[model samples]
Target: MAIKGSGSPMEAVDEYFDMLIKSRFIEMFGDIKTNSKGWKCHKLGELGSFKTGGTPSSKHEEYYQGTIPFISTPALGPNYIDDSAAKYHISKEAIENCATTLIPAGSLIIGTRINVGQSSINKIPMCTNQDIVSMMDIDKKYDLLFLKHCLNQYIPYLDSQKKGATIKGITVELLKSVMIPEPPIDEQKQYVDFVEQVDKSKAVCK
Candidate 1:
């Protein structure tokens, strides 16, 4: 796969990592992707493993309050999770008995059901419930925030899948199948900077 620069703003809004030829896009859709750049594309599963978290048994009331933060689907935000944001905490004993898993800080976590598209990069080690999935041990070459955005970018497709009483939200198999853009770290940094600048500008306008 070829490493690509983030290219112009033209490359930013591509459909879930589909790097169409800039010229072809212009010829077909007209001049919009004039600066679109090619980027390496990969399935989310190929980049890292998705670990679904487990919830501690409620029967064990002792696990309800402790020092270790316990993350739930509600804790997930669209992009960032703070170290102080977890609403529940668990005890070491509950972790042992209940077999909850703790992913490291910097891992990108996303909710799989209920509020489906919620996502964020956890700032500390924490355990999430079964309703969420974490990209544990993400490949070092990709930026965490960048990956979150890429995943978030794929959310609409996830939502478009038919829902029913049996399957109301994103499933692991579906989530794993989405293709994502893999730009060079340098290009990713540029994308990050571009986003920050846009945010700051919005704040100034406010």
Candidate 2:
């Protein structure tokens, strides 16, 4: 059966699941308070390396028209990502010089400059423009999905701390200092699994 919103029950379910996940997340982590200097803090560069992306010089004919997915800040939407609708592409040569560091599938891509903490996990290997920050799991100890949730939790605070007048931005240092609860990997996976199941159930209900 289908529901009214977004023309499909699945869409309605997805929206409901998103809210449920957020609420559950706060219930799980909201009370474990920490002082500003007490939590285990590390700079983003220390945890994982990141690099900016570039535009394949449009003047050159060979710079584009290939299978590589080129993503920009605007592509990171509210809930879903539309990879097929990406705006640009690059040749093997452009990939070599411009976006050499390929963001592996499932890694979190964060927008640091304008939007601050907006992030999404790429389901396929892709490259991003300068405005995005791709974070790979350095030690496999942290769940990528959990980290994404943590980032989402911190967005409002990060936005409030923006120092730039004309162009607000968060430095690598600031991002790193943002504390995250270091739960066991198994527990993290369980949380993710539970959320996924809730999403599935919502879909069925709708």
Candidate 3:
């Protein structure tokens, strides 16, 4: 259907819904100041890849005792994540068998099930359980720190998309299909730099 100017009643209805979707996005992620049309919008999957992890064989006693960090929903913190926070460690044998993907240091993770909307960046390399989704190999064109804050702003939208009457949860497909606004890299860097300075002043490390 032609979007510029709807001619028939049905065409008008389609146009109306299109505008409604964009308008909601504007409301959720404030209108871009410099951009005339608005920020560039991209599906989460287009920007990067998504991976959901799996548990190794629980029956194998050796899989439970190893060096590789096994991340879980309980270990997730708002801003930071320590792999050590994970209760279980997977062995090399488990990694060869059950590992679907490896989440690199500084990559973002969010729980898909019970702890919906909570997110954190891992400080060390690790693998997560099936209940969570992790974004790895994020496109360098976008600032990671900036993307983190944008996701922070986007938590509410994610919550609203949750399905299931008894248990609220999101699927990997749901997360991958979500659309996000992308400000220019330069604009993103400004926000990242500002936050770093703020954290420094607060002595965030201590």
Best-fitting candidate, scored by TM-score: 2
Clashing residue pairs, backbone N/CA/C < 3 A, model 3: none
TM-score of each: 0.75, 0.76, 0.73
How many pairs in model 3 have backbone atoms within 3 A of each other, for residues 3 or more apart or on separate chains, i.e. clashes? Answer: 0
Candidate 1 on 1-206: residue-level lDDT in tens? 33266654443433213333222223332321122345557778888877888889898888978888888787775356765777888888877876578888888888888768668888778888888888876787787777776665556667777376885876788888776666678866766665555545544544
TM-score, model 3 to reference: 0.73
**Ranking of all predicted structures according to lDDT, beginning with the best and ending with the worst:** 3, 2, 1
The CA lDDT of each predicted structure is: 0.69, 0.70, 0.71
Local distance difference test, candidate 2: 0.70
TM-score of 2: 0.76
Locate the minimum summed-lDDT window of 10 residues in model 2: 31-40
Off by over 4 Å in 3: 1-37, 165-167, 201-206
Could you give candidate 2's per-residue lDDT for residues 33-150 as a string of tens digits? Answer: 3533243544445666666565666677776777778887777734334466368766678777664456787777887778788888788888887777777765477777777777
Please name the candidate that would achieve the greatest lDDT relative to the true structure: 3
